[model samples]
Target: MEPELFIPARALSKFVYCPRLFHLEQAQGYWRDSEETRLGSHVHRVVDRPGSGLPPLQAIRAEGWRTRSVRLSSAELGVVAVCDVVEGVGDRTCPVEYRRGGPAPGGGPWPSERAQVLLQILLLVRHGYRCDHGCIWYDRVRRRVEVPWTWEAEREVLEALSEARAVAERAEPPPPLKHSNRCPGCALLGVCMPDEINELAGRDPEPPRRLLARDPDRFPCYVTEPGSTVGVRNGRIVVARGRERQLSMRLRDVLHLVLAGPVQLSSQAVHALAEQGSPVVWTSTGGWLKAVAVPVAGKHVELRRRQYTTSPAQGVDFARAIVLGKIRNCRTLLRRNGSLAASDRARLDDAIKRASRAEAVSTLLGVEGSAAAAYFQALPGAFRSDNRLPAPLFEQTGRTRRPPLDPVSCLLSYLYALLVKDLTVACYALGLDPYFGLYHRPRYGRPALVLDLAEEFRPLIADSTALTLINNRQADGGMFEVHPTAVALTRGGRRTVITAYERRLATEAVHPVFGYKLTYRRTLEVQARMFAAYLLDEIPRYTPCTTR
Candidate 1:
């Protein structure tokens, strides 16, 4: 087995409880604090420390039992663990694992808790130690529940090790547990979002309100000031405005950070962030990713494999909803901006119908392209600008990406770049492979999953932001620079557009299917992860996000 596939003995309980939870914590390096986790931490603190009453492990049987907090490893077992206590009486030794809660309601130990101790015993046996029994010391109950090392119990331990290794070795995180009761208050709830993804996968997601607790203070930070510098000062991230230290924040409070050009980040700060497993991305002044600082510990090896190896038939089936969602959103945006004439509206509707009925990805791609053509042609009508765009630029016969031909074109391209970054971050958080795409053809460095995710939000997020800025007079001709071969946003123009983009992400909208209010940023992540769940066969189907 590869070194990366090694499973810590303590994680057996988590793996037994839920493989997805185990993957999220051990593979992805995510943890959320809650009352229960805190209480467990407090309990561990007492048992974790070596104290006056506890005896060393080697000095045994005679003067009662000896105990110690010990680290044991077995290369053959591919396991290493720190047992809370190991007690010996003459030749026989027993491992005692600590838990925060009391014994099982009927007096038997929980299967997961027993598996944890069983793993420690297995490791001990492989390490040439005489270990025949174990017990769980529930702090709340203040008593030990005996677990004799029966062959069946030891067999369970071996099976769990293999099962856990398979899940950890997979390309994606394991599927969410079927029941929502397992989700509420679990430390990984926010990142896992089992209910939200289940809902998108056509399962009874139960209710999100029951599964997740929305945190207002958990938004990612954006640093756009060009001359500012970010560094570590006294264990917190500090920002200096030119020569003046102006801001400070704890690393834990920052979920993500986007840096614009000319902003400097010290090596120490970068290392600190990487150590904490936070994503620090550097974007071009134009919002393109010049580089990204990612944590090395987590990557879903199997998810990308399945993403690219998907059969053409399955690819089209999953992507059909994405294309239809985009087309319908285009129609809605046209109406929102007063550009949807009866004929143009009818055309968009027809495109949507074709997109929905399309059986092949090739056919879907064609319908999507046509819908975009008409959508962009009506761009000038959406923006109430006096300076009409150049005829060659505004003709909008197709979407111009590289060296976007006009101001609206430039805005759309830049906004799509932003969406790519967003989808990329969401992908990493959910353990999905970003470079390998499911529906889009495999391409080097293109982030196919990112592109697949951007489809639904193209009109709802990027187009809507553009129309609001242009039509409401927030940005104008002077704000965009028209070069000999290309158009781009001026510094102030970029800031204005990005500010509006962030605002749109922050704005609350009722999720059409779930009928719940959530920020678009949250909605974007949920959509990406739901697609992941669909790919893993945890959900029956993938449902794309659609706006009314």
Candidate 2:
């Protein structure tokens, strides 16, 4: 396998707060740009806009502006990212990043932002710029906080980078932290379901306490005792059934066998009894038989069914319907704006036209663009199509979701990731207990629930949202002159996208089958429920909805 890439300073902040999250993003490469990430991109654009002021220099004429270009890279460490501003203060240089939000909790500058600055410092140092400090300019707080690169700060930055590298080494995300709440505004919140992991790992494993009573009937053949046995073996209570050697009782299959003498069972037996799906009672003097908790897995399949139920059609249909509705909403919103300039409209129309053409989507799927190819180019085997990337099955050919990299489409795609993230969040919110899963499989510390939840929405949310942005004038590469990377979004681009997403989500649509109008939020919850049902075996499998 290819070695894991080291994360840039900005990403290190994410890891420091939640190692699992850092793993999900950097290691797994399952990036789902969030509103915050997009917004940060948007802001970066504004900062990098032409004629952006830079510090003045002495060599240039008096009217000359002192502006220095910001360059960043961590190639040696295997991390890379760019800085917004690099200032030349006397003989020393400092990097400054504009924060989209307030300082971190306890009044510390945002760790990720600080990390970004440190990386910037490293970049400048590599390029022979005498760097000493970096500053984070908070937009919300309207304050600029300077970060001095002391030995401690540099060590911390390096340490954070090292830890991030370690986390990225795993294909799956790391286990959630023991005490999360370290980084309140972490972008990977949806990816890292820390609460669920914590709950599953920290819970006391010992069986619950039980009470027993004496029964005087069948057990008369055995000896008499009032105490309880502590351990069980071979699915049978290895207790002395009679005066002879210990006899095993099929605790699960047997209903009841009355005993006159006393039989004792340990607390473990009581738990085993309960796990058999029926409670057991052990008599102090009679044969030990009392109600006990049953292991959930042993419960009848029918019992599992009654608890959670959903249909294959329901889940896929729900996901597809949500995507379609959102796409339609995006089209409507763009048209209503009416004030869109010709160039912007032309760009959007071109994107939509491309999306409308059945060939484009197929072409996109086939092309291993530079961005995608860079990561996979070194792989051993030639590209081969499989079920995951099968040729179009539907009669209609076009964007299955939306065209890639359109501003609105970008927003929608990120929103899908957001939804997945939300599912990860919901997994934590709900105490279903198991932290890892089947499709996502339980690693020592992975949050399988979130991975499970995000599966169906990948096509529905992220792909569709990305298409919408392209099809609509809300965003386009024309603004930046350079075509936007499919994976990254500019800051202004992010805000425009997020605002539109929030608006689109609030819009309602009548469910084609249910006949009742449901908000996007409700649809997401239903999809989540269906996932829970699948886990409970109430559904056979999950399939994403395919549009005709």
Alpha carbon lDDT of each predicted model: 0.76, 0.45
Off by over 4 Å in 2: 1-6, 38-42, 50-69, 105-108, 177-188, 200-548
The positional error of residue 134 in candidate 2, measured at the CA in angstroms, is 1.0
Per-prediction TM-score to the true structure, in the order listed: 0.82, 0.37
Query: Tens digits of per-residue lDDT for model 1 on 1-548?
Result: 44555678768789988889998777666665567976887888856776343344464456447456777776667778888887766667788888988888788788889888898888777766688789998888799999888788788899989899887766567767766466776877767877666665656646655444323355566677779999987778888887897678887677677898889889998888876567888898888876666676335645556665777777888889888888888888888778888888887889988988888878888898888878777756776755444334455534577888777788888888888888888787666777777667668768787898899998888888877776676767667888777888888888788889888888787777667777888888778767866776766677778877
Candidate 1 regions exceeding 4 Å error are 1-6, 23-69, 87-96, 100-110, 121-175, 190-193, 196-210, 213-217, 384-407, 430-433, 438-445, 476-487
- Which digits, one per residue and each the tens of the lDDT, describe model 2 over residues 1-548? 43356466667766765676666555544343446776876767666753434333334233323343344565677767556665564657667787778887777776666777877777666666666888888888888888777778778877877777876664334555544444345544433434423333444233211111111111111223323132467776555534544456555443322222244557676676544323232222211122222233221232224323434344333333332333333333334433234544454344334333423223322221221222112111111112122122211222223333333333444455445434543333232332444333357655554545554344344534443444453445532222433333444544454455544545455433233454554445444544443344334433332221
Measured by TM-score, the strongest candidate is 1
RMSD of each: 4.5, 30.8
Deviation in angstroms for 137 in model 1? Answer: 5.0
Backbone clashes in each candidate structure, one number apiece? 5, 63
